[model samples]
Target: MNLGIIGQAAGLYAVTNIDDILVLALFFAQGAGHKNSTRNIALGQFLGFAAILAVAVAAAYGATFLPGSAVPYLGLLPLALGTKAAVQAWRHRGDAEEEKQAGEGGPKPLEVAAVTFANGGDNIGVYVPVFATAGIGGMSAYVIVFLALLAVWIAAGRYFATRPVIAKALSRWGHILLPLVLIGIGVLILIEGGAFGL
Candidate 1:
């Protein structure tokens, strides 16, 4: 395991994923008053990121077998998800608290995971190339570091949620911001990947 490579991969992932902080803060805020909410968020995030890694690694190995043209179309997953979110947000524009209270009824673990996965279209794009060149040992190191950083990310989100000011702000604006972020991510993926020839 190369310490430098691990650190580099971890840093790259962390730095490039600043939007995750806001999304996580939203999750933490939504999970308020629920005992296992944090656990659910952490687990969902892990599942989502693990899925990204799996897809990336698979793409790397399947290069010879899979048609490269088909890969970019994966952007559709996030594009559709984001459009749904935006519509939901727009419908609830006048009732933020009501929408939140409704959502607070349960821990939407799968929802979070799905959004995380969809929002990670860019991560998939970035990771595929990186993992392609990494040998088995380097891949293992990257995985280790990524999992470790995931924990820190969860902790940071939870911590931020505990702060009254931050939590309040997130609760008030997260619904609006999340949809935009998701849509932007989706569009960026489509444009960059040139899905369907743009």
Candidate 2:
């Protein structure tokens, strides 16, 4: 289950059509060989990822320190968060549409990082098992997962930047649908939690 969650974090970036990749690639390409927007985005994503890793690791380790009965509540954290995100996305469909229009005006680096953070939110739930397990080398597992995610992110970014048809479509509907899909995923996680009696 934990591996599934971690793999989702990595795979989601790759499965999205080439459009997201191009936008991200353009971010990096514009910043080519100098301090540019893409560099900032890369920096932001790295820092954001670091923040996520810290939180996930802490969650895992802390769970080990807590009583057995407390584990279920901790397990509920991701489900609750995912549910809330889904609800927010559903409620803010208009905002998403507006943002799509506004996105044409300019690219935002911080926004990229924000999106990256949102994309990675599921990591929290995946860490619970790692933190609770002793001598399982949680750090090693994190490294493996991070490397996998990085590869997928880079490949997708490059592919979309080079492709036109895929890019156009992604620009049109990616923002609108990505959140809905995430919400569905969150609900699925929540259901899984319920099954575990969390």
Candidate 3:
């Protein structure tokens, strides 16, 4: 294993994905009390990141793939999801029974995966050139390190979500805050990518 490659991968993943810790915390907060929520979150995160890596690898190899201009439109996934969540939260406001029922199932794995993939526009952009420059051995090392660190990221998010003070706050306000945050992230992505001319 190349220690330098591993270090580079670790640093890059940490820098690129620091914001994901907060997002994961919010997801965990919403899924509190639901069975298999953590499992689904981890699975979704892996699947989504794998897709991003696959794309980066392919692009590195000069495979024709998604055009750069089309990347920004991926923000629609989170935008739609956030809008739906907001509508649901509004409709169920003050209905403890309905809210409890709604929270019973947690987010679907695919839903989490879609959001993860959609949020990875910058990941793809950053990864492609790095992968292109990396020889096959270095690329493999980077992949291994990145995958391992993903688990650490998930655990950190869960830890934050389960903290007494944060948990209490999220329990009270996560529903509202989650939708707003998702919407804000979506808008930021769109604007940053210059989608629809912002």
Top candidate (TM-score): 3
Tell me the tens digit of each residue's lDDT in model 2 across 68-116. Answer: 4432333243344335444544565566555534433322455455444
Q: Count the backbone clashes (under 3 Å) in each candidate.
A: 0, 3, 0
- Give the distance in Å from residue 39's predicted Cα in candidate 2 to where it truly belongs: 3.0
Instruction: Quote each prediction's TM-score.
Output: 0.78, 0.46, 0.95
Flag clash pairs in model 3.
Answer: none
- By summed lDDT, which 10 consecutive residues of candidate 3 come out lowest? 97-106
Candidate lDDT values, in order: 0.73, 0.49, 0.86
Q: Tell me how far the alpha carbon of residue 74 in candidate 1 is from the true structure, in angstroms, after superposition.
A: 4.0
For every candidate in turn, the CA RMSD to the true structure comes to 3.1, 8.8, 1.4
For candidate 1, the TM-score is 0.78
Which candidate number maximizes lDDT? 3
Query: Candidate 2: which pairs clash?
Result: 21-157, 22-161, 60-131
Error of 2 at 187 (Å): 11
**Per-residue alpha-carbon lDDT of candidate 3 for residues 60-173, written as tens digits (9 for 90 to 100):** 899847899989888888888888778877877867954653644677788778888888877999998899999788888888998999999999989999999999888788
Global lDDT for candidate 1? Answer: 0.73
